[model samples]
Target: GIQVEQSPPDLILQEGANSTLRCNFSDSVNNLQWFHQNPWGQLINLFYIPSGTKQNGRLSATTVATERYSLLYISSSQTTDSGVYFCAVTPMDSNYQLIWGAGTKLIIKP
Candidate 1:
């Protein structure tokens, strides 16, 4: 079993601001993903980055397998970005199952 921890349980950002969310895992992992949970509790996949960096529009993510940590960066935050962000991971030997962290709640102010 693996352990996951997310930083800044809560965050507040002004519209158009940039913010970074961090996730740390206790052990080595093979699969890693970042998700954004909307108000309706629907989880939207942001990235499936086990290592390196990827960017999509105003959102980006980077994972360092050696360091056992990952980061989600939001550029020019919008009101729609206000929600909980989660990081999930799975071991390489496992069946790609995921272990979730508590999540970081983001609030975008006008």
Candidate 2:
């Protein structure tokens, strides 16, 4: 079995601030992803990094598989960024099953 943990279970920031979210896992993973649950409850895929780093606009993510952890970075935060950010992974021992983190709740002030 594998376990996923997200740090800073809750976060509050001004609209233009920058923040970093962290995800740690207990075992090796075959697939790792980041998602943002919008206010409307729609899940938006942010990254799918089993290893290495990736960036998209004001967002970036890095997964160090060897160390069993991942990081998500957000720059110049916006009100639209408010929601729940989740980290999900499929362990090396499982197929078609994703273990989800409790999620980090983010609030961006206007």
TM-score versus the correct structure, for each prediction: 0.97, 0.98
Off by over 4 Å in 1: none
Can you list the residue pairs that collide in candidate 1? none
lDDT by residue for model 1 (39-86), tens:
999999999999999999999999999999999999999999999999
How many backbone overlaps does candidate 2 show?
0
Q: Which candidate wins on TM-score? A: 2
lDDT of each: 0.95, 0.97
Enumerate residue pairs that collide in model 2. Answer: none
Error of 2 at 84 (Å): 0.3
Give candidate 1's root-mean-square deviation (CA, Å).
0.8
Model 2 accuracy (lDDT, Cα):
0.97
Per-residue error for 20 in candidate 1, Å, reads 0.4
lDDT (Cα, tens digit) per residue for candidate 2, span 1-110: 79899999999999999999999999999999999999899999999999999999999999999999999999999999999999999989787999999999999999
